[model samples]
Target: MKSESIVVVGAGVIGLDVALVLAKRGYGRNTTIIAEHLPGDTSINYTSPWAGANFSAISASDANALRWDKLGYAYLLSLAAKDDKDAFVKESTSTEYWDEMPSPAKIDSMAKYLKNFKEIPAGDLPSGVAYGIEFTTITLNAPMHIRYLLRKLTEEYGVRVVRKRVSDITSGFLSKDTKVVFNCTGNASRDLNGVQDSKCYPTRGQILLAKAPHIQQNVMRHGKDYETYVIPRPYSNGNVILGGFMQKGVSTADTFSYETESILSRTTAMLPSLASSETQILAAFSGLRPSREGGARVSKEVIQVDGTGRQGVLVHNYGAGGTGFQAGYGMAIEAANTVAEELQALA
Candidate 1:
C-alpha cells in the first residue's frame, strides 16, 4: 500500500519537531509542514522565535506535564551532546530567593530527575536569597535551532515545508490522501477556519536581548513582586536573553511603552555586572503564547462538517503556552504516536 500523506500545520518548533519525528519513523516522505511563518522571520504571529526556552518544569505535580518535561529535557540534552554543540547547550542554572519556595512534593520529584541537582552554598547566596537550588538545563537559540531542524528534515527525511497561510483544512489544499492533520498552529489555531477553538487564547510575553560581557550561566531570582532571569545565548553572542513579563490576553505585538525600558532596568538591577558592560541593545520583541482552556491539548479527534464523512484525523499539539521549546520533543513524540495509530486505523 502507498504511504499516507500527513499535513502538519505551523512550522514553529512544535510543528517542525513533530514533522521530523514522523519522518524519522519512516513517515517523512509523506509529511508536509504548512505554515504562515517560518523560522528566522520574526513576527508577532510566531512565538517560537522569541523564547527564553529553558527546561524547568513549574508543573512537576501534573503527571502529563511531568512526563513531557522529563522526556523533553532528556531529548534536548542528548541533542546538545551529539549534534552541533553551539545549536543548544546545557549550563548550570540557579533559582534563588523565592518568597515561597516550591512545594515539597514537587521538589522531591525534581531532585530525582535532575542528575546535577544541588543546593546553593549559603555564602554564595544573594542578599535576599534565603534558599536556592542549582541544576543542569539547556537553552536554545530559536532561529539557529529551527534552521538546523529544517535542514535535517529536508536533507535526510525528504519532508516538505510549504510557506502558506492555511485558513481552512477542508479546502482543496488537503485531500483524501492527507489522512492525518497535526494542528501545531500555535496562536493562529484560534483563527483557523475549520478549527476555531475559542478556548485558544494568547498570553503575551516581552523580553530584552542585549550583549552582555562574558556571562556564561543562567540566574533566576524570585521576589514577592516579580521574577527575573538572565540566560546566555549560543557562541558567546555576548548577548543574554533578559525577560520576561507574562501579560495574559494582551495580543498586541509591538513592544509596550514601559515594558521595553522596564525589562532592561530590572535585568540590569539583578545582575549588577551588566551595568558597565560595553554591550549593545540588540532588540526588544514580543510573542503571543497559544494557551488553551485546559493546559496543552495533545489529543486526537475527528471533526465532521456538512454531513460529509471527511474522516480526517487531527492530532492537536498546540498550547505549549510559553514553554513550547522546552516541551516540544516530548509533545511531538506523543503526537507522532497518535499519527501512527491514525494511519494504522486507516489501513
Candidate 2:
C-alpha cells in the first residue's frame, strides 16, 4: 500500500502550526503546503503577521474556545521558557481599566493560570481607573515565530511547502491517496472555492509600531469607548506595538485613514510617557481578523466532489479572529487529533 499524502491550505500561522502538529504526530512524509501567501509578506489576506500576538484572555463563556485558549497559553509559556525564549517572551502583563469593570470571577479564573496574579492598589492605578490585574502572559514576534515554525517544518520534518493558489480541491492536485485536507486560510476562506463558508467574515484591526525607549512589559487599558494595548517585542528591538481598532466587515487594507492615527493618539494619551518620547514611528499596518458569527469554527466533515466518488476529509481550523497566536497551538492540536482519528478509521 502506498503512503497517504495530505495537502494543507494556507501558510499563515494557523496553517504552519497545524502542519507542525501533523508532522510531529508521524503523518505522511509527502505532506505539502499550497498557499497563495506566506509569512514576511504583508498581505491583507493574511492576519497572522499583523497580530499584537500576545496571550490575552478575552474569550467569551464558550467552552471550546476557552479550552483552546488555556491549552495554547500553556504551550506558548512552555516554548518561551524552553528554547524559543529569544523569539517568545513571558512577562507580567498589567491590564488596567478606566470605568470598565470586568467580572471578578473572570479575573480570578485568568489569575489561576498566570503567575503573579494581583490587583493593584488604588493609588498605583492611573487616574479614573479603579481596578487592575497583573498576570504572566506570553508575547511573540509574529514574523519571527512564523518563520521559525516554517523552518522547523521544512528542515526538521521534511514537509514540502509550495507557493500556489488552490481554487478547487477536487481538480488535478488531489489524489486517491490524499486522505485528508486541512483548511487554515484565515480571512480568504470566504472566497476559497470549495469552502465558501458565508459565516466567515473579516474584523479589521489596525496597529502602529513605534520604537519606544526603555519601556518593558505589557500594558492594556479597557473602557466602553475604546480598548488599547501595548506589547514589547523580543530582542530589545525597541519597537512596541500600539493598537488597535476592531471594525467588522471592513476589508480595505490600505493604511490611509486618520482613524488609526486617532487610535494611536488615544492610546499614547493613556500612556503619556509613550507620547512624549522620541520614539520614531516605524510603520502602521492593518490586518483583517478572520472572525465567524459565533466563534472559531473547528470541525470535521466528508465532502463529495462533483464527479469523483472518492471523498476527502476536510478539517476546518479558521475563524480565530484576532486571537490567532494565542489560540494557535491548541487549535492545531485539536484539528490534528481529528484528522488522525479519521485517518485511523480509514486504515
Candidate 3:
C-alpha cells in the first residue's frame, strides 16, 4: 500500500468534515488542513459560525443530496446517542412546511428513520401553508461543534490544521507522499488560483439569536417568496436562532436591522414562545453561503504539479450553500471515496 498523505484546503464545516472523513478512512496520520480561517474565527468568509446548523431533509427532492443528508443524519444520531458530552449533536422535533405536497420519494426516504414523521393537516399548519412534514432530527451549535471537530481531528486522527491560505491547489500536492488535494475552499473557490469556478457565488443569509430555553424544537416555513426558521440550541444555555432571508446575488455580510426585526416578527408568530416576555435578544449576524450555479461540486480533477511534470488529483468539494453543515459529513464521505480511488490508481 502507498504511504498516504492528503491536504484539505479550507477549515469551515465542510473542510473539517472532509478531513475527518479522510482520517476515518485510515489517512489520519498523514492529513493536513490548510486554511485562512478556523473554527473560532468570525468573518464573512467563514460561514460555519453563522449557520442554524441542523439535520433536515432540505434536499429531499434531489437524489444525490438526499443520500448525503441521510448518511450525515445517521452519523450524527450515533454521536448524539453515544453519551459523549461534547458530541454537539442533539435530537429535537423538526417541522417543515411547504405550500404544496412534497415529492413522494422524499416522504418515503424520510420514513425510514423518522418513525414519528407524518403530514400535518392543512388546518393545523400556519395559514397559507398547504402541506407539512414533522420528524425527529438533530441540530448543531456550529461554533461549539466546529471546535469539537477540531479536537477530534487532532487528538484522535492526528490531523493538523495549518493557518494559511493557498494560492494554488498544487501547493498541497508538493509532497512526494501527497497523492491528492481536497479543495473544500467554500466561496474562496471563486477566486482561488487554479480553481476559479465562475459559477461560485454567495447566497447571503442573516439571523438573530435570542435567549429562549423553553423552545426545544426546530420549525421552518417554506414559501415561494420568503422562508422562515426557528432552531433552538438545547446545549450551553444557548440562544434560539431565528432566520432568515436567502438573498441570492448578494455578497455583503453586514447585518440589516430591519431584517433582524423581520425575522423576529416572523419566527415569533410561528413559535409564540419566542416572543415571551423573558426573551432577550442575544445577537444578530450575517453569513455568505458558498452557492454555485449548478449546486455543490464534489468531484475530482487531475492537475499538473507546478514546475514538475508529475500530476495529481484535486478533489473539488464546495458550493454547498446554506446546508454546508447539514450536508457536510455526507459530502466528506464522497470526497474521501474520491481520494481513495485516486490513491488506488496512483498505486
Candidate 4:
C-alpha cells in the first residue's frame, strides 16, 4: 500500500510532534510540514524558542491536561535516558513555592514522578510563601530539541517541511495526494482562514537568558500578583533562563526593560548565583503563546474548502499556550489517533 499523504500546518512544537507521530504510525515519507517559520528561526510569533521548555506538571486539576502531561513526561524521560548527544532533554530538580497551599489536583498530577517529593514547612518557607513542593522534572533546550525533532522527522522518518505562509487550511497542503490535514498552527489559529478560532488569543511571556551554569535546579515562585521562574539548561554550556510574567491577551512581543529587571530580581532571590559578578546576561526574548479562552483544542473536525467544495479531515492540535513543549508529544499522539480514525472512516 502507498504511504498515506498528510499535510501538517505549522512548524512549531505541536506541528513537528504531530508529524513525527504520524510518520511513526505508518504515515512515513508522505507527511509534510507547512509553516511560515522553521525550527531554527527565532521570531516573536514563534513561541517554542522563547519557552523555558520544562515539564513542571502545571496542568493541575484538568483531567485531559494531566493525561497529556503524564504522557509527555514519560516520553521525554525515555528520550533523556538515551545516550545520544542530540537528545536535548535532561532531568532537573524542580522547586515550586506558592503563597497559598497548592490545589490537591496539582499535587495528584505530579505524584507520578515524585522521587524525593516534599512539602516545605511554613517556618522554612520564604517570607511570603505558604507552601512549596520539591521534585524532579524534565527540562529541554527548546531550540535544540526542535532541531532534534526536525532531524528525526526528515532523516529517519522521511517527513519533509515546506516554508510557506498559509492563509487557510486548504492552501496549506502542498502535497496533491494529501488526504488528511493536521492544523497545528499555534497562535495563527486565531486568524487562519478555515480555523479563525475566536476564542484563540495570545499570552505574552518574556525571559532573560543569563550565563549561570552554577544554577542547577529549577525554581518557581508563585506569588499573589507575580510569578517568576529559574530554569538552568545543563548542556552546550546552556544559559540559565530567568522567566517572567504571563500577560494575558497581550499580542505584542516587545520586551519591556522593567519586566526584565523584575525577572532578574525574583530569580536572583531564588538563586543568588544568578547575580554573581561573572554571570553574563546573554539575551532577552519574548513570544506570544497561543492561548484560548478555553483550554487547548485537540479534536477532529471536517472543514470545507472555499474554492473546492470537497471536505477534508482536520485534526486540530493547537492552543496549548506555554505547555506546548511540555505536552507536545502527548497532544501529537492524540492528533495522530484522530487522523487514523478519519482515514478509517474514509476507507
Best candidate per lDDT, number? 3
Off by over 4 Å in 1: 1-4, 58-61, 90-97, 121-131, 171-173, 223-225, 305-307, 344-347
Off by over 4 Å in 4: 1-4, 306-308, 343-347
Can you give the TM-score per candidate against the true fold?
Answer: 0.90, 0.91, 0.94, 0.94
Clashes by residue pair, model 4: none
> Candidate 2: misplaced stretches above 4 Å?
1-4, 28-30, 85-92, 96-99, 103-105, 121-124, 128-130, 169-173, 345-347
Q: Could you give candidate 2's per-residue lDDT for residues 295-340 as a string of tens digits?
A: 8878888888457576778888899887788888889999988877
lDDT tens digits by residue: candidate 1, 120-185: 787877677666788887877776788778888888898887888866755413666777888898
Q: RMSD for each model, in Å, please?
A: 2.5, 2.4, 2.0, 2.0
TM-score-best of 2 and 3: 3
Every candidate's lDDT: 0.75, 0.76, 0.82, 0.80
Ranking by TM-score: 3, 4, 2, 1
